[model samples]
Target: MLTVIMASRNGAGWLKETLDAFAALHPPEGGWKLVVVDNGSTDRTSAVVRGFQQRLPLTALHQARPGKNAALNLALEEAEGDLVVFTDDDVLPDPDWLLQLRQAAADFPDTGVFGGRIDPCWPRPPARWITDLVPLGLVYSLTVEREDGPCDPQWIWGPNMMVRSALLEGGHRFDEEVGPDGTMAYRMGSETTFTKELAAQGARCRHVARARVRHMIRPFQMKRSWILGRAFRAGRGYWEPEPERVAILGVPRHILREVGEAAGRWAVARLRGNARERFRAAWDLNFWRGVLHEAWINRARPKRRADASRPGARDRTALSAGPD
Candidate 1:
């Protein structure tokens, strides 16, 4: 049996499409269940799920906490299948997603966690170069064939991932301190960390190309301002070591280094071809801009320490102390 879980917050607009895609995958044998953890959505997210109850074996779990990992933990407690699959609310799985995942699991029974490919559904010409150059969209989506081996700790993403229930049973859970709620204060390394932990436990993790999902891109995400904002937040999340230590003490050097590195890359790409090089240059520039901007904001803003013993404290402390 397989259990599909999704964590959503005010995702009513997109939940219907996500649920519809999952509903289309109900196996004839009827050994699958869809579980949704609604994280205190003010929108009609619950109502939408209620509507889908008749069409699919949908169960909605509510968590008032505003964290993605918190919601995931709630779903994990309810999931009752040999295999547990996770997808984001803004994503729609490929029609044969479950079938492909089942085949992958069968081919490698030792595999504890598996992540599928995700691609942007909408294309923005203005940012196309940035997308192409950085491959920022989905660098972890590997094209390798089926082979049992240790999973790369850095290649996991939550949108299209599956983990054996045994892994969870063994006391594994996503880090609640980071992810979507952490915003600029903390960036997500949970997927990577979780996959690595599983691999360290002598379990195999693999990437399957067939288990695909299309990530929806909103108009806001395409705008330069929004992109830069996300980039800055991502950099802050990446650079800051602990949530409490994200103060003004270490911003200058970090900003200079990030910007300098980006500028150097852009200069190098300029010597290459126009089509690919320009795109690469744009992406590098944008990435650096985000990093530098984040450092500047970190320096300018007042610091507030919340839950000093949180999971990401080490990273935040490192950022506070000095360069990483």
Candidate 2:
């Protein structure tokens, strides 16, 4: 058996559709169960999940903690089965999603991490301006074309990811700071940091092209402000400060210079460039601003990675949504 786990907060509108899609999934051998953690949602999220109880071998858990990573870490505690699949509540899995993943896991017993394909489906086609400015596939966790073989663990997006349950049960955890909290503003690349650390520690990784999910790109996410904000969050999420590099106000000199250069280019583009060119430049500018913001915030604080910072995280039996 395998466990499919995800977290949702006030996402009831999409949760129904995601569960409906799960109902259509073709069960893999040895069976599977779903574990969804409600991260303090005030909406009908619990009701929606309960409706799918008969359809899936469902286990509902609740984490009052604010962040997505915090919720996911809770699910990790209750998840059974040898393979643990991680996905989002806003995605539609293909019928063979779990089947392919299980087959891949069986074939590659050496691989500790597995990333599946994610295809983004929007309510309506986006305009050329935004399309040209954003890397749709990269930004939306869409398709990353490549052969089914060994790949970087960092390439695994949260929407379609899997790993050995034993690995997580062995104390590997999601860093609460990197994922979505109960807010409009937050950092991106929620799981990449965890995977990067896993790879560095010698966990073999693979990309299974057949296991797929379609991530719904919400309308609000298509807005310009959201896109710009994502650039900033990605900037903060993606930055890796050089330990040996000298810094002023916690930001390295080269990064500060890059910020200046980005601003100048954006100004020039705004004055003379076309719509796409201008937005692209603005995107770069927002990215550097995010990088600078993260650098400044962490400059004075001692560096430490801890999941216990999430409220009540030390309690193993606190999941409020009941057992499987």
Candidate 3:
């Protein structure tokens, strides 16, 4: 059996359609259940879920916390299946989504983690800039377009991922501090962190092409400001490079080198008058700026304990929203 879980906050508008998609899913060999966690939604999210109870194997739970991870933790308590799948409220799954996921699980029983493809469903025709940024993962999350096979777990997005229940049973949970906080404060790598930790514990991930979902893209996400802001948050989430990786004369020099490289890219783009190149350069500059911005923010704060001073430790303590 499988259990699908997702968290929502004031997402009633999208919840109804997603529930309709869930109701249309063809049952797997052992069936599946849906667990929707209401993360302090002020809208009609609960009523929407209740309306679906008679049509689907749906269970509604509430987490007063403000973070996506916190709500996911609440759903984990109610999830009851060997294979637990995670998705978002804004996604519409394929009719055979659960069937495909179950088939993959059966075929690759040894692989404990799985990710399916996520294609974009734009509300309107995307702007050229928006389309360009899609490959950068700033426009929409879960952009994996890999062939069916084993892959690095980090590419998996939270919106279309499944993992063995044993991981959660062993006390694994999403980092509360690193994901969406029920608002526009977009943080990156919430699922990536958990996947990296899973890989560290000797688990590999499989790519399931058939178990696909269509991620809804709002028109606002296509704007330059939104993309830039998303890039900034991504920079903060992915800023904690290994000391050995960025050890060229320490943090200061390494950041300088990156900034200089980005400036060169911008210069070349401007000289060539290539719109795509210019946008890419701008994205790189924003990401680097976000990295530096977060660094300054962290530097201003009080230092953490010796153990928490290690690489990636600060990200969890300062950026994460849940208990460490």
Q: Can you tell me which runs of candidate 2 are displaced by over 4 Å?
A: 302-324
Q: Model 1, range 1-324, lDDT digits (tens) per residue?
A: 888888888889878888888778737233788898888889999998888989987788999988778898888888887899887887777788888888888889877789787666664543654454433432222223433344454454677788988888867897675565623334535555566567767767687877888776656656555444444344444443333443336555545665777777767777765556655555556655645554555554435323222222233211110000
Clashing pairs in 3: 176-321, 176-322, 177-320, 177-321
After the best TM-score superposition of candidate 1, give how far the Cα of residue 60 lies from its true spot, in angstroms. 0.4
Ranking by lDDT: 2, 3, 1
C-alpha lDDT of candidate 1 relative to the true structure: 0.64
Give the candidate order by descending TM-score: 2, 3, 1
**Predicted structure 2, TM vs. truth:** 0.90
Candidate 2 C-alpha lDDT tens digits along 1-324: 999999999889999999999999999999999999999999999999988888888999999988999999999888888999999999999999999999999999999999898877789988877666576644676654656899876567788889987677669898787768886557666677677667766788899989989888889888888777777776666455454668886777777997999898888878885677778778888877876886777766525332222211222111110000
CA-lDDT, candidates in order: 0.64, 0.77, 0.74
Alpha-carbon RMSD of each model? 7.0, 6.7, 4.9
- Best candidate per lDDT, number? 2
The clash count for each model shown is 6, 0, 4
Q: What lDDT score goes with residue 216 in model 1?
A: 69
